[model samples]
Target: MPVQRRIFGRPIPAMSPRRMAVLLGTIAIFAVLTLVFTLPSSIPAGPSLGKFTDHKISLPKLKHIPSPSILNPFRQAAHAPPVQKNSTNGESSWYSNWNWLSPFSSSVTLDENRSLLPPLPDRPPIYTYYDHTIEKEQELKDAENAVLLTWRKAWWAQGFKPIILSPAEAMNNPLYTELQMKQLEAPMMTEMSKWLAWENMGTGMLCHYLTLPMGSNEDPLLTFLRHGEYPMLTRFDNLGSGLFAGSKADITAAVKKALANPELKAAKDFISAVPPETFEIDPKHDALAYYNDETVADKYPKIAGDIVGNGAKGLLVLNQLMISHLHGTWQNIFNRGIAVVKPHPDHMSYAVHPARRLAEFLAQCPESPMPSSCPPNRPKCKPCVASTPLKISTPPAYRNTSDLYTIGTVPHPYTMAVLTAFRDDISIPWIRRESPRDPWVTALTKELLGTGVSGAPRVIKFKEAVASQYGTAHSLWITAEGDMPDDLDWHFGFAIPRNATDNGRSETPVPGPERRPPVEHDFKDGPVPTEAELEKEKALLKRAKEFGEARTADEEKIRGAIEAWNLADTEAWKFARAFLARSSVERKKWEEEEKKYAGGAGAERGKSEGWGRWFDD
Candidate 1:
């Protein structure tokens, strides 16, 4: 009989030893199978188990580890341990051994030499300001765009960030607004406001967009960053306000100092106190005269010295001339290399004053010698016969003197000086026939003359020729009783010069007895003139006298306009000369430095393109 155990008070029955042993064996096998299947599920899913696969550990071996026993076989699967949670608490537990299964696991070995991914360097900002208020014309807008474009490209190419702000952006600051409010009252304030606006904006670098040329390979901003100790870094040592670079703190401090200057304040006060009507006559007249006054300079020696020493006056002149719209004035300034056109040569001399040199030349050569040959005195011959009668016409009168004043004005003492110098020392001499025969005038006359017939046909031909030579026909066309000829071929019997061939002979051949061959005549001192020829010569001389008188009148008008313009800039011109004289040593040193760096890393890379030619021209 088998004894069985009973719950509560029930009788117990006992079974055979063989049956009990078999039952225990079956229970052990069930537990073993459960462990075998459930062990894998305990390990994390979706992890590379290849590293652990080659090891001696096996599933059967893992079954030896302790696990919760299955009290009911049916519920054993449901009660399996939860899958190992990721180490979200940022810590490892006893189960950390299994962390190798995760790619993000800290336990996994990684390449130690791999970079941590460094951040990019900060690029220095270059600030350029434009005043759109005044630049209304398309030509002005185009010019401004061209200049700004160059600045943008150059700065970008050199690893800098250029920020172009307009008057609107500048006016956002209260300080800029305050300065601008006074510009109408005091025109000089217009320029001063620009400086204030630049300072108000956070600092890194500053320059006029119109004035900055293309940069060289050597990074000037980088150099300043690395070695600069001063609060401000000017292009020349305290020479000009055109360029500056520094930290915000330093720039702010320096600008504040300049703004708070006592002399500057006094000058401003003096100018502002003047009656409003004074400016109405000539807006810049009072201001110009005040700055240029010897007594005022004596009273404000410090400011005067500072202005001259720092080259502010000189730079002011350049800025004024740039916006002046004066014909050839801008071109002359550029050609003279007054601004940063290109580096000056080592041998270049600045000792002699340009004005003085020109004056000396004028004194030595008062007038050009007249040509040796003259028209002979002969009896009047038959008047030159024109195939068709041509009409006489009056040319349009020159622009009024008042109209000239509206072209431009120079308010700065230094600007006035430069313009006066340009007009007297350069412009006047350049055009005056008595001074020298300008190659341009010579070439023009050679091209237009000697092709037309005598009398009115010749006169009409001259007008036509001038119209063709210049840009506008309206300006050159004679204001005649009848309509001016629009036909391109109206020049009666006049031949246009043909292009030269490879051998330097005219492409157009002369119509003559070619088979017989043309004879080259040497008439240098040959036969007496025929009566008809003398008549033609007399007619030509009379026509020439009329042309000369017209030309002289035109020249006089041009001279008067130029003189007015020069007078407007006289004070500025004088100051600039004095400034130059005072800063000769510094100027020499600057030029030497320029020469040293001209072709080195500091030299401009490509030739400045675009409207830079407006300056370079």
Candidate 2:
């Protein structure tokens, strides 16, 4: 017989009767109730019973995003790299696996500040593009300035000034005893010396800064920075910082000379319009762009692909590359783009991808001319709304994609309901503590998992979010929102060390390396819940229950029959949204019944006042 092969320590195609049981139990729970009075599908129609409260609310409009260009298919010349080469098997491959200490790939959503879009559901997507050359140019210019400012903030955020002065402080502080000062000065001065040395060398500076990736000589982050054509610095300000502050007089003199040229006036107008905040690198996902007359400038990819579409894979790949290059390590989808200077547990962490300059020209705009990034002229400011409608589609919840980050198809209602409960009710330790169970989550979980909803995955690896090959959380199926996360099973960050036969050290990824021996954090010892536990959680069904409080035997028989039928018709009723809509037949029937009640002098109030309570129970 063939040897039992293990992939990622877990068997492929997965294992168990465990899954079968989970599946069955989930199904039995989520199906809708049987019809108490003739299939109960009819709904109230016509004039609605809309609740009207003067409660002030702010249903913010969806954020507007420039519609990507779908007109031009991603044009690749015959000589371009083959597009089919993109693979979803992340870290498993040699390329991504080699860089262990590096940050996660793009496609993982990480948002630091507010999101680009107002979020899904309440707000529709924003995908309109304006043809305004000057406007986009101005937006880029503003973004570049913002980048510089954010870097300046970093200096303060990191408390660089104190850290920078530490060496000098050790030697100069008189309060220190002479011997103590000497010792203090030695180590502090040594660290400072090392920092300066690494700074000069650039790549080696990473080693002096942080532990693991940054400090490790083996790390690839420094490789990324040095690999660029211009040798991009750890901080962009390093570029302008080199220009002496004392040289401002000379710079001003040169500026006046260039200003004399008539051509410079238009350039000045564009530069004057760039808002500084646009360039503020969030270390998460934020693309600030402005399209100049000649070219478009934005940190984000300019390619337009369809939802789970055309060039999305490529764009996501590029995003991953950039993240790996910038932050040393990051956790995405946990809450968009969360960057971890060190190791972290959750996959979905908040992160931000600061706007990258699309081009040099757009980076110089000044902010005075209504630099809202909106166009001044009518032709360019076309909104996707009334003009060309926006089309939005989520990843498939049911059908699996060839790639890792995308979910297969829309999940079943019970799946949605289960996830909804998990998202809202169960608070993972980091984000929340002692969050109560949400009613929606309670209902959904009971219907799907505890109840045995169909199409539901019996076993879910609740937390696992690293697979450099695919995108991160936000970029994947489960967004910061409580939707389904795309590839729970596929992300393979944990590299288990197997028998010597598995692979040699050479095969191990350079960044993460092979994990230490083996430790499953085994939960296998957990005993099943005792009978007492089951009794506490179990609900009671009262034999005295009846529909519409009818205590008569006829009413009891009809109600019992309805309940029994519902158990058998689980699938059809689970997705029966039609029942939620209003029906004219039901309305007329109710109206007739009301007229009869009025003619019969209110028919002496029913004997059962709170009769339907048990059913709710």
Candidate 3:
């Protein structure tokens, strides 16, 4: 009998080591066979299997593989479809079959042939009008060129095709002629003619008036297209004419509707009712005056009420009526959705700065020949002698000369400094100094600042020199205190506040008004100044300070006069600051919303809280 051994509490027969090894080997072989039968026999052939069986292996097919209770107790045993290689793309079809493992399986689909994304739609044409009639003035032509070229380049960069409709293009339409005729009766019809041109030229287009400069970032037109489908879209909540988009048919219908509206007749009647002398003398100023008169509101209640509702009393009654009618027409035509969006604070601003206007004049008339109206002995005339002043006219006599030194017989250092500063200090939108070494800048400087004694004589000579050399309808002579001649076109002085410091002396010049930060003001319209602009403004103020010092030292009687003179421009500067501040706030809000939307929070909150709804009325 085998020797018995006590193991734990049980008695077992003790065997030799060879017998124990044989027993363990048999159990291992049995387990291998069990695992082979349990696994699915559909596994693809691979290098691992080749190592074991020389690239060939055969296993008996099992009727069923039991689901392991520990791994997946609730899973039922089933045969999975065999994976196949996609012959076209040479990729395995495992992802399509085992989609449950993929996170994006629901949102995206993979196929052998093509992507499922729809192709992007073509962008609508952008239509902007340039009335060549104004090109009669070389300055106007240069200014227009600068603005249009900038506008075209910006739109082109954003994948838009900008079409600058000329007066000739507008003339192609029969309706444009009729609109032009109506302009004789109503001057505001000029804008209507431009709209007609846009409608006639394209099936669908965006109309952005040239005066409103485009921003470098964010394509507002593209954004409008993505979220809006109305027949018409306006830039402001009040249907401002500055920027808008529509289908040709919709624009035509809207224009007709506006023309036919009874309120148009009322608007015309209100304008006709104003005293002819006042209205004809200064239509813009006097028309606004008449509209603002409390008695006039009572007389033209319907039109006046509409203007009031528009929220800007500064506009001409006819212009306001046009906006009101267009808005009403859009609502009538497309009953669903708002036709107007709140204006972007950073874009679509009117280019109304005096600096911009001055630049335009300088650009056009960099070097003008001595006016024919100047006395033949003018160049040799005594500095203090008063004679009939030269009659400087629009489109100043231009001479084709590149020689900067030949601009004037004598050098005027003070004038050269001022003009150089002016040319270098251009910070307006859509305007650029083509060259730092522009010969015209030097020429204009010499022409404006005459070679003479300093003080009252210098002022008289300076005024005469400007009158003779650079007189245009838009020409302005900025001065301190003195009664300007009736013939000379002039304004008060630089739009600098009295309390403002001479930024030239300070290392860190303040960019806002003394009493308040620019951001605190409630401006209705203005572009947010870029960092480059602020820097340019600082440089300008510094130059201005230097100018004031020179002038003060040369003319003792007018000491501290520059500050008092600058006070005249305070209101305009205040408006500018307010606009800058308002634009900054709007831009900040816009950027914050953009960040929130891009970060996926927009989806969780829904469209109501997104920037899209910000445009909604």
Instruction: Estimate every model's Cα lDDT from 0 to 1.
Output: 0.31, 0.23, 0.33
Writing each residue's lDDT as its tens digit, candidate 1 over 1-617 gives 75567878887667779999999999999999999999989888654786777678545444542333433345433331222333111111112232222211111222211111111224466766666566255544544454444444444433445566555545666666545444333444544555556666666667645333221223343444324243543443211334556565655554455455444534443223333222112111110011222422453343444333334343233222222211121112122111100011111111111211211111121110111111111112111112211111111112212111101011222112222122223244433433222111122223344423222232233222222212121122211011122211111101111122112233233322332222211112223344454344334433323332454765556444433333312212222222222223322333245334212211223422322111110
Model 2 per-residue lDDT tens digits across residues 22-60: 988777664533344435457566555355444568887
Best TM-score among the predictions, by candidate number: 3
User: What is the Å distance of residue 110 in model 1 from its true position?
Assistant: 12
**Candidate 2 RMSD to the correct structure:** 34.4
Residue 361 local lDDT, model 1: 16
Per-residue accuracy of model 3 over 45-109 as CA lDDT, tens digit each = 56656666765567876555332332465755454333332211211122222222122221123
Between candidates 1 and 3, which one is better according to TM-score? Answer: 3
The order of the candidates by lDDT, greatest first, is 3, 1, 2
